[model samples]
Target: MDACSPVLVVGALLLVLLGASAPTVSAARAFFVFGDSLVDNGNNNYLMTTARADAPPYGIDFPTHMPTGRFSNGLNIPDIISTSPACLLSHLGEYLGAEPALPYLSPYMRGENLLVGANFASAGVGILNDTGVQFVNIIRIAQQLQNFQDYQRRLAAYIGEDAARERVSQSLVLITLGGNDFVNNYYLVPFSARSQQFEIHDYVPFIISEYKKVLARLYELGARRVIVTGTGMIGCVPAELALHSLDGSCAPDLTRAADLFNPQLERMLTELNGEVGHDDVFIAANTNRVSFDFMFNPQQYGFATAKIACCGQGPYNGIGLCTPASNVCANRDVYAYWDAFHPTERANRIIVANFMHGTTDHISPMNLSTILAMDNTRN
Candidate 1:
């Protein structure tokens, strides 16, 4: 594929209402996405957390304009993944596994449904275990990885090893998480009171270790192709900087934590590939640099408001919940965030653009499309 060629993946030229201009992704198959609020469609109804999207103004710009349990004004990451024809199987992590009914897969996916993936990204999920204590009950990355394990086992039984391996190998697994780990552990939980008590160095290794566990579990389950997205610019989030430390400068403390965390994340990825005895174990999605570049110089990116979110009031001030009266914005595309904590659709698109390049983050060394292209070889 030519780097300079048109980035469009599929021509999904099908009109919305008999005749309409539309952008389409290239043809591919299978998308298994995991992460926090960014990718979750509606899997948290089983939990007991106030941090939820099963409410209004969350999916106002989406097809049904319904909340759908996503933590944004419109399409979150999972929607973006399925919209592309290149996707085959889209799966998310839902709690209670079998105790609760599996969430409904979306209905609009064309020409085969593209296997809409359900989200396992619980709102306050983080790399560490204790991040969502206040929520009473929530889905963490480790638990989600365990669910993947169960899904893989079931697939193995039904399809047999060789065929199962082939399918999983040809598949694309997108894992986007870690922000709440920083926020909840470093600032929200007991850590806030223990501010000077702990250092970034202290927490970095533990989280990296947990991340490795998740990767190893995925590989053991049948994942031959993986796309691990780095936590986007956290300190730049309206939730973080607005209320806690609004000095207009990025939080060196938190930024330093990410800096420490990312390299370790990359090193572990490199190590995972090594353990898998191949260079294709995963793609590192360098989201941190992409976001930092835009944040430090918003003027260069044509975004006038970088530090503040168009959504709320107070410190990093994504400090409050997004109720109907929260004063939603008209053009989420122009703003960096829909609410204080989440990125707007436009920012997500740009991030996806960089992810499509395959080098923007440590999660994918090659874009997910390229990884799926490899699946063609195995097929």
Candidate 2:
């Protein structure tokens, strides 16, 4: 996240409509990040949190079968961003003090030493202050920024202040979260039990207010170019389907929750862009979709297996997790879901392509063209 100023807030974006020219080139390079499990490759190794991926079967698909603290079987978004040349930062001989012959969870300091950026996203984190207070000390948005500052200081020490500043300014700031906020807080545990006592409308607004603090902090901390991914149609997860007896039918309540959150989040971006007087610094990546309107009719979605996951039997039906009696699917590509909650690596790849291309219907930046046009708008 870099810095933004007052430029595109008050309809200054209308320049394109008037056949105006865009900026020359953006000055960012270091993709500093902060969020939950989706973007977290490691970094949490230093923290004593229960929501850890420093175990087996997590990185089964990764190169050399290395478990790099990612919850997935392979590289997550941060790694994808680092794939580019200039943004490519080494994960050895720096963050960990020195490269080691064997990689282990205790020495997670390896990847954090990269120049592209480090991921501070932890699993089970939420926008609200106390969503999973007892389960583990998840990194909240505020705390995530604190870590980002520390990252900045370390980078400055190693590469010098000016270079570090330029790297951060030019690089993308990727922040993916909001799933745990709804799932763990409003739906599970203390909140779920308490939700019955409160109106969902009342509860959601309270959550949004706290989320605002996170955004404000990022903008203040000089995170100019940001990709804030909004929550998707989460009600479709196998666990939720099982819990609510949904039978592959979308939980309208959950859909309503997404509807409530996405638009408000967009407006927050607009207001923040205005508040800071900058162009579209905050682009909301929409992750909600039913894959060609098929999931709505489940029959139309064309899977006889929507109700039960291809992996487990009772609840999540996911085989790959650290479950004792997991059901591993032979062919994972056919199934839309990989685990109870997340999509398959293939699905995520497609989604990332969509996130970059902005072609999918659910979460384009206003429209894909709007984003394409903004590429020319940089100055």
Candidate 3:
């Protein structure tokens, strides 16, 4: 918590990640994170799956210098957002206090911890129930929603139904799904079940339709202000580059899949908001475009390498998980990716900046700052 600490001093400059801050409005905020490996903090650690990060070199750059199942070399996207000054949660009123939401599966995450918020994300999950079946015990989107309902029941027991409803409505909710649908499902097995059932053109729409149900259910469960993120630049990740791009260029096929997914996601979110009679309720964060900025031009973003992951082996250093035997980068700040599929903590920080206050091009309709401003008025 030292302001003069190395990370803090650097954070001051990185705070410019979103360009500029919006008009200020202080209020109490509770943050809830739901997603795949991208936004998962430590939820997957408690699950039985190969899609985990609770091992050496995973959180090498974290403050604890130990793996926290974040799928990054340090703090992941959610952690950066929670600690950033541009985020309203960091400036929460003293009466509300501050604590990163606990993972829903954590045995220690109970009592007062539930009041702060809870993360229900499990690594390898997607919007579809069958998305990450290869990972065996991963929590699919429907199961996560069920857990959310369970959390609500526990919350109502502690603070009554009305208060819990208000807490959920007023609280900040972030959901980062869809990426796994591409990486782990449609493309996991060549001519996979999903791919054989429908081509890319039809598959994207199918995924969107299924995703619509999940968002509708979230709304039904009382998540008024939600930040739904699009999938990142899938083709640009080290895994794709290594497997499909021998020349270090992005795999065009996967990138096309992402292109197909994000725009429809935006339209679907807009339609959902309209159906609910609130324009700002479902905010879309264009993660694909934001990540493409850095992935396409790593040096421009201060990264020495974006194609080669800081860990793993074989081509692009992205063959598998980041273990002790993996080739570890001495300075993760210069790399865009941490492992085969996820970004380095520094890259995640930049993405979080865009989510905090980037314009419509980065975050559609409005950004997190605007959402916070609207919530401030109500709270």
TM-scores of the candidates are 0.79, 0.76, 0.90
- Cα error, candidate 1, residue 254 (Å): 1.0
The candidate scoring highest on lDDT is 3
Q: Which regions of candidate 1 fall more than 4 Å away from where they truly are?
A: 1-28, 84-118, 153-165, 189-198, 315-317, 358-364
Q: Report the candidate with higher TM-score, 2 versus 3.
A: 3
CA lDDT of each prediction against the hidden true structure: 0.63, 0.58, 0.81
Select the stronger candidate by lDDT from 1 and 3. Answer: 3
Those runs of model 3 whose alpha carbons end farther than 4 Å from true positions after fitting are: 1-27, 84-97
- Residue 114 displacement (Å), model 2: 4.1
- Ten contiguous residues minimizing lDDT sum, candidate 3: 17-26
Model 2 Cα shift for residue 41 (angstroms)? 1.4
- Total backbone clashes of candidate 3, pairs 3 or more residues apart or in separate chains: 0
